[model samples]
Target chain A: MRCIIRLTLLEMLKKKILYLTLALTAIFLIFYGIAMNYGYDSLRDAEPLMRIAVSGQFLSMGIYALGFIVSFLSIFASVGSISSEIEQGNYDAILSKPISRYEVVVGRYIGILLVLIPYATFFYLSIIGLNLYFGDGVVANIVTVNILKSLSVLYLLPTLLTSVGLLLSTYLSTMGAGVTLVILYFCGMVGGILEQIGHFITGEAKVVLTSIGITTSLVIPSDIVYRKASSILYTTSSGMNFSADNMLGASIQPSGLMLFYIGFYIIIMVVLSIRKFQIRDL
Target chain B: MMLETYNLTKQFNGKGGFKDVSLSVREGEVFSFLGKNGAGKSTFIRTLLGILYPTSGMGLMLGKPIGDVETRKKIGYLPELFQYHTWLTGYELLYNHGLLYKMKKNEIKARIDEVLKIVGLEGHEHKKIKQYSKGMKQRIGLGSAILSDPLLLFLDEPTSALDPLGRKQVRDIIFKLKNEGKTIFLNTHLLSEVELVSDRVAILDKGEMKKIGTMKELLHSPLMLSVGNCSEKIINELKKIDPLLERVGNDIKMSVERDNDLPKIADSVVKNDGLLYMMKRKENVLEELFINTVGEEDVR
Candidate 1:
């Protein structure tokens, strides 16, 4: 198991994609910092405008940046975890050793997360640092909350995505798995919106549509978690507002219940993935 | 039996893989699994190594069920078209594999050097696998397989990418391991290599065991025989002795039905005023046996 983890980490670290991701992440942070400074300068005299605009912009940037980073990284990292190796016939060499398939799956997931955590941490810190430098003084408590929320979402969301990716990669070819997961990721993003539109038309029918959307989101949790995390980061002390009508409407900050749902979502996806992989014909 | 399969059948959905294939390989022997491309050679190796599960039936390695983790500890494997992490140097790959086998770091380092030397990859240890040529990668792969001195080693086309000298080097290492009491399960299409190294060989075609036995046993079977040149009239005379006798060009080919009849045939041919060009026993070589049993259509 340790060998699998070591090998996974070593292999991922050498991939050009990892460096590309890191470079993109750094760019996101720099851009966010500049954007926050410009917004802060515009409303420098108005305290309420300064606070709302700066906090809202920083929150939005954090959500977008981290969400995109985690989604992109998870897709790139996990989609080929098994399929590429199997395609290249490298798994033959590994499985021929005294390791079980379960170990390989679990070890690879953890290793990918290990690589992801550092990037997430860097982005989370960059957002908070930019908020302090440009906006109000570092609300250590708020920053801590925001960072914790982002980290949890980072960890839980990718775990779900990685599990889905691993499950797909186990049976499909690399390209097939990759394209399927990308489609799944996008569907998950639109799922909630589709459900709400269904609700506006009918009630009981909406229940079924909502459940379907939730189920789809559970299968690929990137959008669900990202939206939930975005809502949480944007929510202020006043109240949760996701309405497009209110110009001041900020996305709801993820509440305790939302966080728990994300956690449960991640666990269930991981368990399903592990079960599927154990019985898979690798 | 050091390794055995019983009624093992594996079938892919549309296409077939292996079916009710059964054979045994004894300890300290070079057992060659002869098959052409997609002849279930790799599928069998994968099943034995726990890379793939059989649809039905059973196989045992080192007295344990096939693919058993404990059984794998005592086994080593080299895939036919092996791919290693290109970022890793030859030494790192060996070291990493050594660690998986639970070798001490110091022991792994020492074994790394020894195996590198054994595979003739001594100085190139520091070079990344991507930098190595195909033959060099194969040598490195072979080195890793034998790194732990496993009780059993499974090699799939172990010398497919090697030149003559490299192939000889691989064969020598296999032979040395066999002499040291390691059971080797070699899967290869190289019949000459099998004939040169195998104590026993199994011919597989269309996922079935077509033939299995020691080289000598296979050679002495009715499927093989020795013939000497004799006069056409004598060939006609021998036809009286045996209905299977036939003359082709300058030589008389007689199929020996029994071992005792060999001396009689030799004497008759000599007395017939014919020169014996050669009297050599022939068995289907691994390649011929594979084709004959598996059918030529299966060999891509």
Candidate 2:
């Protein structure tokens, strides 16, 4: 397993995928940096609420953009963890060694996470830096401890999505896993939005959206956790009287229980992928 | 025994796997599986390596049940057309392989140089595998396989992508390994390789073992006699000396227990009004035995 991790990291570096990802992230940050500056400049003459509101909008967009980039990286990185190696007939030589199959799967997961975690942290911190600069030092009003909480919760979203991609990889082909993950991503996003706003819609529309949300949540709850993380970032005791569950300033926050559930989800994905990969013939 | 299997069967939904194979390979011999593509050679090796579960029966390698990690420590396998991590340099790949075998860092580093030398890859260690040609990739693959200096080696078509000289060089290495008291299980349809190095060979066809024996035992030395027969008298006379003598057109083929019988058969044919055009010993090559054993099907 150590060998696998070491070799995988070496491969990523040699292929320049790590550097490429970071470079792509830098470009994204540059664009975000420019947009944040312009958005803040426009809000200079606006009312304080409207300024905070636009700044908040920029902050949310920054978070979502970072989230999307991380999600894309995680999915593409993990979707081929086992299936591609098996397809190319490379696993036979490696798996024939004294190492257990579980080690390979878990080690691969660690290798990918090792690359992604630093990527996530760098990008997440960059966005926070932007938030501090463009939001007129608005986030400074929030406690540093609360900022840490929000950062951690925000980072966990990518980790959860990565686990989902890995879980799908153990059974599906690379393309199949990627497609399924996209579907699941949209499901979580739509389900989070519709279910949170189901109260305004009357008649059967409410019933249909609620059913979709319930089913998607039961199956894959990563998007809901992401929304919960957004709420954690902006919502406070002195915040607006927002009834919107999907909003960052919403009153309905995800409980601590869901954090543990995401933890459980990671463990279950790792275990299931290992179990399926153990008996898989290459 | 270095490896043994008793009625081992590994069928994928009752197709495309070996069946009821019972064979024992002693230590320090170059044992080979001679078969064409889709002939179950790779399947059998995969099963023995614990890559695939046997549908029935059992196997043991180095006195432990198949797939035993401890037992695998003494075994090295070079799979067919092995596709390595192309982004890795040859040195890094060998180093990683040594780590997989749980070798100490210093020991792995020390052995990597020697392995690279043995595989004739001394100067190319820093080159990425993507830059390697087919033969270079194959040699690097072999280098990793033997990095731990295993007691038993399994090579599937080890020389498939190699040139003629590369094939000979690798073959010499196999011989050297055998001289070092290492047991090797080689799988290939290359009859010449089997003829030169294999102490024992197993012929597999359509997921079944057709024959298994030592090189000499498999290749029956037959005397070929081409003649123009004047009567059935020569045929009856030849049958008296060997009941299994076969008549192929104007030629007769019969296994000779001794060279003295050849003279007697020629005298009988000449005295019995038979015109003996030629009298010579056949090549008794592995190709003949392979053809005879598997028959001429899609052994390709």
Q: Best candidate per TM-score, number?
A: 2
User: Tens digits of per-residue lDDT for model 1 on A1-282?
Assistant: 888889888886766667877787788777877887786666556676445655565565565667666776788788888888877878888888878878887888888888877777777667767876776642212435655665666566777777778777777887998899889887876765555455455768878877776677655556666666555545444544322212122232234575676677666656666776677666
Residue pairs clashing in model 2 are none
Give the per-residue lDDT digits (tens) of candidate 1, residues B185-215: 9999888888889899888877778888887
Best by lDDT: 2
Structure candidate 1, residue pairs in collision: A231-A252, A231-A253, A232-A252, A232-A253, A232-A254
- Kindly report which residue stretches of model 1 are placed more than 4 angstroms away from their true locations once superposed: A137-150, A192-221, A227-255, B221-300
C-alpha RMSD over true interface residues, model 2: 1.2
lDDT of 2 by residue, B52-153 (tens): 888998999999999887777788989998788888899988988899999999999999999999999999999989999999999999998899999999
Candidate 2 wrongly placed segments (more than 4 Å): A137-140, A199-208, A236-251, B223-281
